[model samples]
Target: MRDSLSLWFIVKNYRIRSVFIKNFFIILSLILLPVTGFSVGIYQLYSKTVTEEISSAHLHSLSRIRDMIDMTIREADNYSIRIASSETLATLMSPSPMHNYDLNVNVLKMSAELNMMDTMRNFVESVYVYSEQNRSVISSQMGRWDLEQFLDQGWLDSYNTNKSQRKAWTVARKAKTFQSESEEKTLITLFRLAPLLETSKLGSVIINIDTARFMNMINQTGSDYIDSVFIIGGDGTILGSNDLTLINRPISDVIPVKDIAEGKPNEPVFVYEDESKQSVSYVHSLYNDWKFVSIAPLKLYEDKAKYIRNYLYISSLFSIVVALIISLVVSWRMYMPIKQIMSVVSRPGEWLEESPPPKRVNEIKYITSSILDSYGEKRELENELRYRLSLLDRAYAIALQSQINPHFLYNTLETINWQAIRLSGGENVVSDMISSLSQLLRFSLEGEDNLVPIRVEIEHCKHYIDIQKIRYPRKVDVQWHLDEKIMNYKIPRITLQPLIENSIYHGIRPMSQEGMITISGQLEGDSIVIRVADNGVGADPDKIERINQELADKNWITANNHIGIRNVNQRIKLTFGDQYGLHMASVPGHGTTVTVRISAIQA
Candidate 1:
């Protein structure tokens, strides 16, 4: 019972069902848009927050490494100044040859003190003193040697190259203090002129630092986030770096010098290399003007936001799936009612599909077409019924006009015709007129059908003309120029008689001389045209205009003077349609012409 009621309700409201699926999708989009936007917004916010946090932490670590490197180099510079000013080193470097015993004691004391100083700092590789006047060298690790025999000649060359400076640090270079050493050691030596108070420079004190040990100290201050580190001199030279091959080279060769120059004193800058991006952070040292730099991969910073990005992807996919399911379920529920209505209204073989169908077979369109077709059929039936009723009314009106004892009038006319023939003792004009009158009355009263053959209508018109000829005597003549093919065509009964009547009474009767009435029939396309013309004094232009206007406007009620012509025009249009009707034309002294047009219907 519930199913039946549901079906009944659905069938009754099937007119509005087409918009259900369209509206469902609209609502689904409204719901899903916000869900998708919110998920994306949350992911972007979280990713931005995480990236900033990681960049801040990495920058702080780089700053700590910079401070550590600066302090170490400051300590090395202070100690190098102390050794250069020592009296024992200055006396040993004098040009005068010292007594062998005193020279040996002074060298022993200086070597012991240098060795102790080298041991104080883990980054310091060795310490030595060179006597330019004696051409001798003293080392903290090795005892003494003549300048030519000493294996570590790189420092002497470096010191000689920049002798004008009171103190300076050389670029990284290889050194060997002993002949038996298999491999050269990489060093950055600090050279200072001896005897700080004297203007005459005799010799120099040197401090050799191991590049590897220096870099190891820098590495200790760093974290895994850093890809590499370097200590760059003010002249753009890489004075210290974890990669030994990069040491002593221009820092601009490995990183763009412009990028570093663009950064503020202590800040991070980003640079892109072919396929990867790196973040470079550095701090400038106030003591030596050297830059402490750290390079880290940018991908590592973005990795911290991966969790939020993954959640966004998952949430977006889930939301899309859920929205699709909800839209489909809702649309299908609404569409089921329309589908049921389609099945009930359509023919037995024409059921709507449950799945999406083609445009022509859509449930709503099919139902709409069915309803429109039914309405058209109903309207057509009503029009036909009204047309028949109108014809019956006209027939009844005609019957009323002839209702003065129609049978008795017919009998009286026949009796008069027979008596006139007997009184004349033969067929005379009076008897002929009586016979024509009887035939006209019987044709009008007895015929019930609205349409008659052209031959029959033409015969009735001749009877009217015969009576008119007897009344006018020798004043009127009639002629028929008709086509043989039009004789079989059907026309409204007594159609041509009224046209002839109008021409005789209104056109020929008013003339002083004998008049001629001519009737002609011809085929024009699908219609048959009949023209009735009379040679007499025609009507005035105004009267002709008024009569034609009445016919055109279907003004049947107001047209009393030309009622016969108007009635004939009305009947032809009602029978064959508006396109078939009568048109009148006249001239002041010439005859009048009435043209009758009707569809060629041959039965």
Candidate 2:
């Protein structure tokens, strides 16, 4: 009888059933919507971050590779210079009593030296010198051959035709060289004409450098993420590469070599594919007019990204299932009680009121109460968490600013040292001055808050300017018009240091004659006014006005003078008030004056 009544009660309870269905759908949507959105957002952000990091890493690797190539080229140039100045080479080319002195002995000696050079340096595959005057060829490896027959008979003729106008030329061609049995031996030769004694002299010296070593150096410096390196010459030839099959191949058969040769130097280009069916490539041209390409598979990082995406999707599905299960449990618990009440009411009015006291399970009662309490607590906790996250964001910004400030100061000091050496100052004096200034500046930068007493700030600025004066003794004139009364007032540390650096770098360094910078500080009514004025090629009024506007609007976020000025201005206003900030005035060809105003803070 009770089971039948319960079934009837359950069928009659439409409100309870509707609530269960509604909550189930609501819970399902809630679980799915945010999870989907969050997963998408996270995936996009991760992808972007990964792409940027990879791009930066690739660029850094390319830069290092370029440096290595430049270094190697410089070494080759040095060798050429040494050889060109040799009396043996001169005598062989001139063939005169003042110079000749037995060509056969000198040839043997030159051959021995070249052999030793090749033995000592793995990169020097062979060394050959061609004398158009004598129509002779001398090589360390092949010995003297008919200059014409060594390469194609027409090769020397072509080289001679272009030798007068072209200072140096590099071409990729097959060369006979010893190789290991296991190694596929395809060689590309780099040939450069040593500077001739006379501009119009027909005789030229050619050095054949090992293309393998050059490619190896580039490959070592390139990012491991890159699959291969290709060295392409201005002429349509693949000079060197890790892939032996491409050696001495025409550029037209491999990639867009003609387009690159005609393109602007150092301009980076992306090639989606090439005829060789290699990976996607990013190409950069060297200063010597050679092309460097870094190639990597397009799908290298794609699988990882896809894996992450799949994991996120699976996690979202799992979360939704869990949410749905919890919703069903809660719905059943709530509806069960309503069903019991309805059953009693349907039985009899008396039973409905009296049986309301039917003992509910303690566990169920506790769960019902906890759910209501948890709903409110969860909302409150979320709000608190968001507030804390906002605070953390601000703290992160402050941390970034703190870290960047010291690094900038340190790099600027290093730049000053280099400039001092360039300006011909004694190394010992410059080192000592830099050491002392570094100690003082480090203290200032690593000290407490941004605010320091005016006296301390002035000392820091003075030490910096003193280092500059040592480098440019009679060239710089610095005038300090500081009022003693304001020395006790607090100001920002290293605030004036950048201004002094700018005065030296952008102002004094450019002028051939004398340059001057004037620094003055005084107290005006409850405010401290500090001015740094430079008498060099000053700022344009339009630029100054634009910077001022940007500072006032607080639009400067990038690292530059305008940004620094804007930041200092904004920080001052934030710490004090809008009235205390920066005011800039300049006249082109006259000078520039930067004035910083801050409320006087007692030491």
Candidate 3:
């Protein structure tokens, strides 16, 4: 009989161990998996958000640079028009009807006046008159020159043929005085007819412009980001440039000919890579068919974006690592008492049952003596009742662990309130936070039922949703569906709040686009099922499986936020037996859903 009793005792202890292991696994799944997932998700989200912001800023900078180039080209075109329409040129070409004697004296005086006007203009490098009759060139600087040896037939033909048509022609060539081998140095000349009279055709006006001076004016109006600007003629010849060395080179040799040819009439052409393989060029063509090109190195802008991305990644990674370390340390500290209790419970069955009862201290003896004197024989019985009541109260209190510290909650709410006031008071976020806080606090402090009415649970969820909505207004959406018959059923207080908080803070917050959180409850057979789902970053299968394994092994207490699901599970098992509890299912990108099962309570 004694052997049989011992066998029975061993079996009972083994059964208890099995139950503890099962409970451990269930609790682990509810807590650790969500915490780890939340941390990683938030980190990735922060990284992506910072990356997109930097990219947008880079694009804006590129657009501004393009606008600056356009403005510079426009300014250059206006200057060209001004020189073409100068009143001095018109006066010099006016008709002299009489074939007068003293023609040299009159012509000399007119030439001197024209020279003086050219000096005052500053932009004109040289002003000359070409006489077709004498084949002589007279200039302000070069006094007299015979055009026979110096003027090319191509230039003379273009000038003589187009003179009657009154069409101006421009040409780019090495400056007549150039002494250097530098490729960029060159000169541009504008040629037009100066009709001496209606009856007599004598000569034309030739204007030579200093290309460097023209480029300087263009450069002054352009952005500092431009490395160089080019002035290319219609025939793909480099007329002038900010870079002097490129002045006389053919455009086809320096830039791709296809690019300039294929470019739109007025629209700028953006080439990603140039001859140097380092810069990007934006090219625009003037009405005169000269190409205005701005070259800026791509490295200048790309470096900025790269720096920002690197800095953001490093900072986010460091922050997450530090936060995780701190959380682990703090959680371990907070979990000490519960860990001690678990350790005591996990000891060998024989050792626990054989342990001596705690000895009464001097204070307890004195309290007992006082009670005995005051109540006589009834003191012993009343003392036992008081002890049992105290034990019951302690056990019940352990069922609910406040989601956030009271001080933290109050401070956060206070901050939200002030921010809401500043945000122009219209259904402001602070009001929502305060309402959520009030509901959460009321449920924590006054809803003493192990199973609260379903209506109260729904209100708690709504309040939590309101606070999250305020924090992430554009990112999180909440939906609620409830069955009328399940309204009166009771649930453990503070049970669903953590799940909702996890959904918002971990799930919805990580998504770049807006996300939704759903809370739905319905009656199915004899049980009511409540589901909270979020269209957020969902759980990893490997992690979920690992957490399940940890739960099965009763190692979940080693994980983060030990009190959340474990405490709720314990309360449910103690109040309504082991059949009712929480269940979770998830898929990546799609979302996570948590379901709580409870027996429907009759009104």
Candidate 4:
């Protein structure tokens, strides 16, 4: 018994230790995959990936911030438009009060007019209506008053200055005492003229949004990656910011906005820096003529990735520890079965060699009884594997057959193409059709791979367009706006053919006179967007919207009608992620534009 125990410890214990060490090494190697791929020798490539991801995240957050700002500005503009267009406000703001006896009625009417802005639920610090003719201010806090005491000289100079546009966006400042300290809050004011039919000078309306409240809204909407948010003018005049010190200061030329006015409106300007340096991203608001700048240290941009990396490291460590324990357990379990066989081997040789009945004990019986039918069982497994391979091969062959059938058409077309060359010197109509048909077929069924170069897809489209132009030679004209730089980027095969086909069939052919189909490609942000537009009788707005909805959902129930477009949309999504796909914008009488969105990436 002591001998058996000693042997068990010596043999089984060593096996457990050996297996544990081997498995731990394997697991540690596997845990280091992310590190080897990006963390170690490929540090520069990993940095670029991290930077792009961070920039994209910042851009997305900036979009949301822009939306919130646009919405806020729109609400203010709407309020001004509403007040300007109102007949009641026009009557109240006239050169003279309309009624002298109806003082109470006028008060009630003005009070009710003031209360209209309250219902909007926006963060309005105060509302004021100032009459420039009389130099009088009618505020929500203080009713109608004919005085210049409400505003300081500096405040009045900025407001009356010709700097801001029709919608004057004033920097937040502590104006002189108007009504009370209760009404005072460091505020940015928006000024709009009360709309009138005649050229008679009336007053302007002032809507103030608290600087703190505005910045709070900005902070809440902005992602953690945005370290600072700024609302500045074209000349770098700081209109608003979370930091009060930055609020009135001139923007440093280091973060330039001088050429922002020259830049096309709505385009974002981005500046990036190293890990220790600050990065700045800004967008110009066409409505208010103010640019919003979001600045952050580069490390903040990678903070989320840093957290994820740390988490992965901790998880790998924990997994390696757990794998060590599991390997020991598994090694011990395996040894039990082997130990039973070893016992049989050590027993009397003649009895062991006998073909014996199974023992009742599970470990001994399980080890001994399975050996007799091992060859038959191996044969059965081999047959099952063969059956599976046969089915897979047949399925693969059927798929190849489907793709191969298109080649038969290509072969016949090639023969006709050669015959056309013999008949008409390869320049006649049939020759063109055969050549186009062959190219189209090859493009459509070239290989199992879905992606092809943009140049190839463009050529495929041009070939299809050539066939269409021949069918209606007098009416159709094609213009190419291919960007040479993006031609090598891979797009799903035959992507533009369906779009061009739709433009020809549904769009151009429907129009009466000569129609033009324009195909354009350009880099819009990080995406390579290709647009197909036709000056044809466009589809009804309702139908266009329905088609767009269907494309978005990829719910192609009827394969017969929109199969080509459906396939293109699905292929675009499959090749690039779900965020990239087809979009449609159309005008009822003018034309329809189909947009194909693909991520611009190297093959």
Candidate 5:
């Protein structure tokens, strides 16, 4: 007997220890293995990825600037061609005979046309036609000037020198405007000879483009990573730039262009350092043989790389700690089922009522017995639940049967109403009252519908008001001013009649003079509002405030007073949402208005 006991102790101890050891290593391996591998190589991978992304972003910005410049140049060339081919310029340039009045009119017309063209583009400073043969220049701003008197005759020299060039874009130069008092603005001119089909023309059409505006366009694309943007010509000259001072200067004078010149022609983008040790990104434009360059600080990229390295280190440390904690949690979760089985075996009195587990039983066999016992308990509970549900279904059916009385009452009222109308044979107050009451009963019996159309609700409300008017006999008046469009929209059924009844009982019946009641409804945004107002005896301001508070109360159903108003408010909220309901306003001796707000739901 002692040998058997010792063997049982050894087997129990070995089973527990083996389970813990096996599960600990298995969970730890699944979690820590991936974390360990990730920690070793992630830093280098992140650094290379970030660097490539930054470089690609810089290259993209350069390309955008190039496209903008190319588009602007194209627009200027198109405008130049349009002005040259205009019939006004053509008639002015022809050597046909004309009177002084016609010549004056043509010159004025050409000046107006030039002025219109100048205002059409933000970058175009001025547009003008110069007639070298006529020795007269008609500018958009300065009007007509003789060849010698023109302030910008410098272009004529180039025009005469380059006679073979039909159209050409001149380099940037300071242009003197007609208003000499104004500051001189630097501009680039596009010169197109007139009479486009002819080898030679009588005059030239020149469009002046503002260089400052070009700088503004380039500066708009600048960000923290970019320092300077430049448009450099193929001959190493800076044609346009964000820095106005650098315009028309040699590219080598501002920054090192040697590396760019040495770059392979097939490569569209390249990065290099300038004299100030700043990194510059260059993009070569195949459209115009120009280079778009953006300068950035090398320290920025290095700082970003350093940040990535530090972040990776911190993340690796955190992941290692989290992995250890997760492994512990997984081992504990796996051990819980075994622990539960032991607890069940120890206390077999709960589920195993007939045949309890033996004290020295095997754990696997005891667990199997516990599962079978629990399944038997579950089946008993399911059977009891089904029996209770059957009782509930019968109770619900009994409640449905209770609605028959209201339906019977509505049918009986309809029959009596028609009989009274037939016996009267003509317009009788008793017959009309019975008809209205019967209609009211019919509307009230429609309990299956949660919502009814506004038109139907209004008709039901009118029936109630009609009966009240007969009882009061000209002592009360009810008016309706509802919108025709909102008639098709829906509201909670039997909502408006209760408020009308409340208005007559509480507001108008106590007054000595004739009382006025107004029912108005209209759509306001996404909601519909209907107000029932009476001008008879109003409540005290404090009492009105309390009634309004009760209308807004969330637990209004439990209150005793103002049952009609509270019921309507609660129904609106339950049907639509808490955001919709009723409100009340009144003065002590004047009147009260109960307003109903509901969502604009279509039937």
Candidate 6:
């Protein structure tokens, strides 16, 4: 009893069934999107929050680092100012002849100034005064060290900047003087240009700070999340790095310099994410073309939000699952009527695939009735189209038969020509005329096929022109420039004969002078071109254009006589393709040239 009741409910009228299911689904969908979308939206919001936090934190830490870097550079600049202003150091470095006592006095004066400068700054490992005048190296600690041991000639050229008087930075190099073999010390040099005093040379001052100390000062300002820190010098090389191993490496080696150059300058921080490494960056421009770039792992900040996302996801999953189950139950109930309708639609000629029939409703009956009516109308239309097409085929056959029938006309012509040949008593003109006439009739009545070999087609045209020759004698002449090699190519039967006829009646007959027709053939790559041009009374340019337009456009309004040219054009195109057709070219008082183009298909 319960099974019967359930069946009855399912097989209820379609209008009521569709309305109930549609409203139910509408309510169900309204419930599902918000719940699912809210969960996803919440997750995205949290993700954005996490990204912003990392970026904010990155900029903040770099700001601190920037402050520290600025302080160090300012202090170094102050040191440079002091060194530049030293009168005793300047006088000692200036060019002069130095005897033993004079050299000693000058050396002592330079040493005292360096010692004072050294006491004022703690970061400087040593300050060297390279003098061009005396060609000597002077330092704060050692009065004189071998110039080669402390500073190479290469260092002079390597660190030379275009501009002078400003402090310049260099990539880390092996500390020249103070280093133990157990731990190699790398130094980043800061060079201060010694000012010119009375056009005397004071050379320059070089300050070397151990790279470990220089990088430490920059790294210490950043937060614990920072994965790597770099100090890139103006020369595009890494000057100092927290990872001592990366010192002296070009900025291009870590990140593409092109990417850096094109980066948004106004962006507080730049984030680079890839499979190999993910990090947020902060770039702070320092004085003298130095950039402090810090890359901190993005995963660190992302991990901070992971637990929150996971907990929220777990909570939302249960609600989605419950809603999904409810949706499935409602959707399954809605699918029955839709499935039945689709079964009929997917197959065009067939209707139902069921063995035991399902119950039908008034809506189903109406739909089936409408579909049957449409199907019946389509069948009737198809039958009518077939009937009309059959009539068209018969009409074409009758028309073709009228042109070249093997019965009454062709047979009678052949009989008369044979009689004339027999009775001519070896008269060449009568025999030749009968021979051409009989051959032309036979060629015409040969078969129903449209295409014929080029030789056969040419012979047919020659035959037709021969008959015209008998009528007019030397009034018209045909100049054949056909290439014997391409003479075997197949073209539409009767193709050339009609074109020659048009030239004669329309062109040659209208002119006062003797008419000449030129027919030529050549292999033009993949196509055959046959020209039937006449030296007849030329046509008006505008009339020629109108005729060409009509021939070009099949649907153009045209007179009955234009049909021959238009038919030839359409036939060639239909036989070969649209690319091959007839073209008419003419000039006033010159002539008209009608060229037939078709595929060069040799038999």
**TM per candidate:** 0.57, 0.46, 0.37, 0.40, 0.41, 0.48
lDDT of 1 by residue, 174-214 (tens): 77756787988777777777755467887787888898887
lDDT of 5 at 404: 71
Best by TM-score: 1
Model 4, residue 499: distance off in Å is: 99
Q: Name the candidate that leads on lDDT.
A: 1
Ranking by TM-score: 1, 6, 2, 5, 4, 3
Q: For model 3, name the residue pairs that clash.
A: 25-551, 183-245, 184-244, 184-245, 184-246, 184-247, 451-491, 452-490, 452-491
Q: What tens digits encode model 5's per-residue C-alpha lDDT throughout 448-496?
A: 8879899998888889888998899878888889999899999888898
Root-mean-square deviation of candidate 1: 11.3
Clashes of each: 0, 0, 9, 0, 0, 0
**Which portions of model 4 show Cα errors greater than 4 Å?**
1-41, 97-99, 118-122, 149-155, 163-172, 176-184, 253-275, 300-603
Q: Which regions of candidate 6 are displaced past 4 Å?
A: 7-28, 116-122, 146-154, 159-171, 179-184, 196-200, 257-259, 266-277, 324-603
lDDT of 6 by residue, 1-603 (tens): 234223345447454465445655675777777987887888888877876777677767876777777777677666765765677567666665658787778778877767675433555666677775566777877786556666434346644542253444444676555434455567777666665343433577767676777666666656875767777776767877877787788877876535444465324444456643345464656655677777767776567567767877787788767776776577666665555455445442465323223366477655654565576677788997897577557546655656654456667766776777678755467667767877877786677787888998998999989988997777789999998888888998778888888888878887777799999888888988888898877789889888777667633322343337776786676688767888888876677899888898977
Give residue 593's lDDT in candidate 1 (0 to 100): 92
- How would you encode candidate 2's per-residue C-alpha lDDT over 383-427 as one tens digit per residue? 888975775576557657777766787778778877887788557
lDDT, candidate 4, 1-603, per-residue tens: 235534455456675464434554555566556544544434456656766766667767776787788778788778866765566566666666456656446545665676587534456766766666656666666676665566533356666674335444555575534544555456677766664453553766677777778888789878877888888765666778887656667766446544444554333345555435455667767466677777756675467557766766676677667656665566556555665555544442333456576646485576555543453465578897797577556545655666666888899899988988898765688888888888888877767777878887777878888888888978889999888889898898877888888888888887778899898898888899989999888888888888788778733333343337766886677568779889888887789999999999866
Instruction: Tell me how many residue pairs clash in candidate 2.
Output: 0
On the 0 to 100 scale, the lDDT of residue 547 in model 5 is 77
**For model 2, what is the C-alpha lDDT against the true structure?**
0.67
Tens digit of lDDT per residue, candidate 3, span 180-285?
4344335566675554223444566666666777667656655545666676677676777866677667766676646555654333333456333233343444
Better of 4 and 5 by lDDT: 5
State the displacement of the C-alpha of residue 482, model 3, in Å, after optimal TM-score superposition.
66
Task: Record all residue pairs in model 2 with backbone atoms less than 3 Å apart, i.e. clashing.
Answer: none
